[model samples]
Target: MPDLRLDTTDLERAATGLDAVARALAGTDTLAGDGAGDLGHDGAAAALRRFAESSTRRRDELGRAVEEFAGHLRECVSTFDGTERSLAEGLGGAA
Candidate 1:
């Protein structure tokens, strides 16, 4: 028979990596200090400023999504670890 034990180390590592990715995504702010704010609030420059603002908002939304994904991954790993433990204990008793 083959050994089918669940090893959670890989999942833990993946969760850690996902967390790091989330941090990196959140840390990025490409237009944080862009001069769009200095532009006049009229004419074509106004439209450009609006576009920049929208871009910033989009970036924020994406960062939030990635962070949420990381959180979910971590939660799944924790659940999987607990389930693995339960199965192991149950199986040991049956052996």
Candidate 2:
């Protein structure tokens, strides 16, 4: 269904955004313990913290999007099952 396609697309986009956030977090971690002086350390720590927060938020958003997409998929399966049952019953009655 079109709705399912749209939901899938949205889920993919959210996943991609989360991946980018993860990459940024990894880059920040590389800056740690490099002994770049007090000011440099502070700046790197701040940047790392910001990246961590962004990653957390993006991960949360991705999780919610996955939940929504799964719900939609379940609904679609249930709908198809119901339709198949109804069609089978109709054919049985005719036979």
The candidate maximizing TM-score is: 1
Superposition error at 60 for model 2 (Å) = 0.3
Question: TM-scores for all candidates?
Answer: 0.65, 0.55
Specify the highest-lDDT model's number.
Answer: 1
lDDT of 1 at 10: 71
Give Cα distance to truth, residue 62, candidate 1, Å: 1.0
Candidate 1, residue 64: lDDT: 77
lDDT of all predictions, in order shown?
Answer: 0.69, 0.57
User: Stretches of candidate 1 above 4 Å error?
Assistant: 1-11, 30-33, 37-41, 93-95
Candidate 1: tens digits of C-alpha lDDT, residues 1-95: 99766556776677677677767766776463366556655566667767767877777787778777767767777887777778888888421
Q: In angstroms, how far off is 6's CA in candidate 1?
A: 7.4
**Clash numbers, per candidate:** 0, 0
Poorest lDDT segment (10 consecutive residues) of candidate 1: 30-39
